[model samples]
Target: MKAKNGLNYESNPKHTPGGQGFRPNAGIEPVNSFELFGESVSVNLKDKIHKSRYTMDNKGNIHRFSPDNRGNYHWSGSTADKIKLNIPN
Candidate 1:
């Protein structure tokens, strides 16, 4: 099966027992930098299983990155309205 974004989901060998799979088709991208709360933050928004993950910086500020209903990824703590990432299929 193919997702709207053009990612193939049929018999993905990368699918693991933990429900986490890597999207090989969507080549990995470098960490993205964005401004949050008037400060620069580094967010690693890679394509992977649709799961919620959290990270914290040395300052103790927490950041959340998760998938939405459409399978697009977004990050929290950003001043912008919504930074949605739609990896190419």
Candidate 2:
């Protein structure tokens, strides 16, 4: 999921009768919002860099999420609560 974000570049292929050429593909359109635990949270990408970001809650605890080069997402927060779930690709 993180790899699919706008931070990376993709290839745009153009084919003709004889050959094909490639160019840098544009990034996906920015997503301005997303749902979090059934609640819609606004997304802000203006200050976001690369493939990681941090979110802070009202209690002063910080939540963080980012993806590693190996295609696994790493998550850590100030709280110890854990939940079992899978994010389908």
- Weakest 10 consecutive residues of candidate 1 by summed lDDT: 33-42
Off by over 4 Å in 2: 1-48, 70-72, 77-89
lDDT by residue (tens digit), candidate 2, 14-84: 21122254222312111221111112122456664445444444554434444457644333222322431
Clashing pairs in 1: none
Which digits, one per residue and each the tens of the lDDT, describe model 1 over residues 1-89?
33333432222222222335654433222233122212322344555443543444455545444445674444433212133233322
Q: For this target, which candidate reaches the highest TM-score against the unseen true structure? A: 1
Q: What C-alpha lDDT do the candidate models reach, one value each? A: 0.35, 0.31
User: What TM-score would each prediction reach against the true structure?
Assistant: 0.28, 0.27
Model 2 steric clash total: 0
Worst window of 10 by summed lDDT in candidate 2? 29-38
List the pairs of residues colliding in candidate 2. Answer: none
